[model samples]
Target: MQIKANNPDEYIAQIPEDRIPYFKKLRQTILDNIPKGFEEQMSYGMIGYVVPKSLYPDGYHCDTNLPLPFTNIASQKNFIALYHSGIYASPEILDWFVAEYPKHCKRKLDMGKSCIRFKKAEEIPFDLIAELMQKLTVKNWIKIYEQTIKK
Candidate 1:
């Protein structure tokens, strides 16, 4: 679902009430695990963690006015979606996550290039996600982005 919100709080408030606790926990997990320098804000209609302009002055290449998005979380119609640019940009991280997913989650991973979809709240693997969050620091992400995604 597309939620139009000014901030992360507003975004979570619009998600299904029943999933509030889970989303809150998931959000907290990211906040606690993601490396320092990534700022939380409303990004692309979801809760996002980004490298602020102060760190990467160029910001997102697609839009210089915005920060460089590192990750995002959103409550979709059928699942909770996590978008991690690191996995998309770094093959090593993707391979690590792919190999480790089965150990943490019973369901086969439902994923796209960068989006990990958890169809049920109980199926989400917070611990694995936390580890994934720590794999990429702001400097590492920017370096990867510049080398691979920025063009």
Candidate 2:
């Protein structure tokens, strides 16, 4: 579940031992695909990727001192959650993910506007996840974020 931790390593360490490698693989995939200018940290009791304040001084609209959140991966009680702001902000990307998900995954995509939930590690559509991670850069996300706030 939402085990609060002081940092990313601590947050990851809180994962169930048996599930460590599974989460690690997901984490590594995100790391490999994440564009430059994003930083990884512990945010909202989960592992988060964000656009640092150094690059965007306005920071997150919710809290000006905090970075703009891009995505997050969390180990939950019944499932693991992957949250991506890009998919939530862009209908085209969301549609693309929905249409392509079945091609790569056997399970139904348990999802919300931004959060994709996986009941088991095998249920994760990693290729799609990686592709989505790669698609959103800091500059692109900032543009989307600004548009969203305006709306």
Which one is best on TM-score?
1
Clashing pairs in 2: none
What lDDT score is found at residue 49 in candidate 1? 97
Model 1: CA > 4 A from native: none
The 0-to-1 C-alpha lDDT of every candidate, in the order given, reads 0.95, 0.88
The global Cα lDDT (0 to 1) of model 2 is 0.88
* Cα lDDT for residue 54, candidate 1: 98
Model 2 stretches with alpha carbons more than 4 Å out: none
lDDT of 2 by residue, 46-149 (tens): 89999998999999888888888999999998888999998899988899899999999988889998999988886677788889898878999999999986
TM-score of each: 0.98, 0.95
Give one digit per residue, the lDDT tens place, for model 1 in 31-108: 999999999999998999999999999999999999999999999999999999998999999999999999999999
Lowest lDDT sum, 10 consecutive residues, model 2, at: 142-151
Candidate 2 global TM-score: 0.95
Q: Give the lowest summed-lDDT range of ten residues in model 1.
A: 116-125
